[model samples]
Target: MAVSFHSRSNSYPSRQHPQAAHVDEQLTRLRSFEAASSSSICQRFSNLQDLHDSLEKMISLSVTNQVLSQDQIEKLLDGSIKILDLCNIAKDSLSQTKESLKEIQSIVRRKRGDLSAEVKKYLASRKFLKKSFQKVLKSLKTGQNKNNNALAVFGEAETVTIALFETIFSFISGSKACGKWSVVSKMISQSTVTCEAEANEFTIVDLEFQSDKSLKVENVQILEACIQDLEDGIESLSKSLIKYRVSILNI
Candidate 1:
């Protein structure tokens, strides 16, 4: 082989190879950094003023940042206080609403109790009236079965009629006082029976005594008839009251 001499400047090197181009760029960057460090001038004069100015700027920036941070913390605290105030107001409103509900509950219970008591009283009064009416009817029936005299029957019926009238008067008075006059009206319209009895007796000696006394037997009979009619009227009223017991008590 013939040896060839080539200049070093024209020689191909691995550093300049295509594959190592990226590595060469890195080495060039490193050399630049080194040159900048080596060739940098070292200032001889005092640069205290410039240093002071830079420090002042840094200090100002730090103080501004601290002020901004403090402002943010204050804003956060204010927001928390506002939220707490709102929560307290809501709690007070809820408490008032609960008290109102309790009051409403009490009113409803009291009204219910009052209505229940009235119904109980009405039922009791109705039962007593029914029992009394039945007893009177039974006594009348028994007397009729025994061939009782008309006078006795009339007297018994008259007594019962009087008792019934008194009872009706009391009921009406009580109902009116309670603002329940409808009860009295119902009793009058629904139930009653008229019972009348007539009897006659002739005495020969009684005629002589009546003439001496200037008394007319016909007048006596007329008066007796009138009294019987009055008793019958009372009986009719009693029967009417019994029939309307339910309606009257309802009022």
Candidate 2:
């Protein structure tokens, strides 16, 4: 048999070969690490995309809500403007009415003054006439014309009392006229007012209301007083006339 020589292939592998195998094992480990890193990168990208979608939805919702709120605010503002215009109209109307009332009050004062002057003049004339009649009756009572004086005094007294009645009636009619033209009717009609408003968290507003009823009551009291004075004057004059007639007849 030929001498069998131990071939290198049948012996242990060389250091170089083992080194190559170790390199291959390391490359395998590197490839596996690269694959895992790629998977992690893909997961991160998907998460980012989902976040971007959520942000876009939030932005769209915010814009839609903002637009709706703006529309509502515009409608509310329009209503407020209408209310303000109405208030302006009411103010103008009230001003006109006030001017009219002032003119009426001025006319009333002039009439009241004329009536007062008339009453004073009538009272003075009546007083003078009453003195003259009393003097005539006194002279006749001290003389032989007593019966004639009694007749004359009775006639004079009747006339004076009748005149007094007319004056009192005139005063009553004047008081009634005052009541008719008084501000009571105007005051009642202007007192009714209503207003409503809407506001957010940052504003406040005021509505106006007015009244003049106290003025009406004051005028009514003045008219009542005039009536009372007329009644008292009439009663006093009647009593005086009767007493004077009786005295002249007794003499």
Candidate 3:
């Protein structure tokens, strides 16, 4: 007897399959995870960048002038410790974000083999977004590492500047040098104001991302926008740090 084979329908059944429902649920969770993690990662980066800017300003001020008051030295030490603590916090947050991404990736991979064509398209888009997000996260990690290295250099520079300042303040304290130092001090003070204003802007941007409702994985354009914003911010931050480093070296 000859056996007959029927063609399979591409359409979903009137009743959903258990596996398909599970895949849908996983995708929904993945969307939520991605949005939350992106917001958290961006906010942490913003805070880290703000701390870096503040520390750079303090380091610049410490070195720009040949002399420093006892009060100024104390402030620099306090600020240095604060920046280190903030860096640690940002690092922890980054680690958490990575874990969250990994979990989502695992969930998707587990169900990917059984996915239907329509569902596969959704998964493929998600994978692309995930890879894009991973790039952003890697950029953030690189930036954080750079910040760590900068912190070390800044700390050493600060130590040398403090020792020199103490020596000059104790021995020379020339009236003309003091006058020049006063002008530098005012410039540093203005830089602090600028740092605060920039930080406020970053906070507003962070909040906007945190509250964003369109970051769903199904909405590819919005997801891409979020990634693009992160890339832009990272580029801006890199340029600013380079400029600050050059200025510090000149001083």
The candidate scoring highest on lDDT is: 3
Per-prediction backbone clash count: 4, 0, 0
lDDT for each residue of candidate 1 in 69-154, tens digit (9 for 90 to 100): 22232332342233233223323432332343334334445655443343334334434543553554344343221212212221
Tens-place lDDT digits, model 2, residues 1-251:
12232222222222134433443343333223311122332232233223223222322332222322222323323322332332233234324333433443454566554433443343343335335434534433332211122122212222222222232222222222222222234433322221111210000000111123223423433433433333343334334333432332222
- For candidate 1, list the clashing residue pairs, or say none: 191-239, 191-240, 192-239, 192-240
- Checking candidate 2 for backbone clashes, the offending pairs are none
Give the lDDT of residue 204 in candidate 3. 22
The global C-alpha lDDT for each of the candidates, from Candidate 1 onward, is: 0.29, 0.30, 0.36
Q: Which stretches of candidate 3 lie over 4 Å from their true place?
A: 1-36, 63-218
Please give the lDDT score at residue 5 for candidate 3: 26
Model 3: per-residue Cα lDDT over 1-251, one tens digit each: 13332343333231143433443343333224321234544543443344345445543552222233333334444544433333333334334433433344445457554223333343344335335444443433322212122233334333322222222222111112222222124334454334334332222222222332222233333334444454444444444445545444433
Worst 10 residues of 1 by lDDT: 36-45
Quote the lDDT for 132 in model 2: 45
lDDT of 3: 0.36
Candidate whose TM-score is highest = 3
TM-score (C-alpha, index-matched) for candidate 3 = 0.29
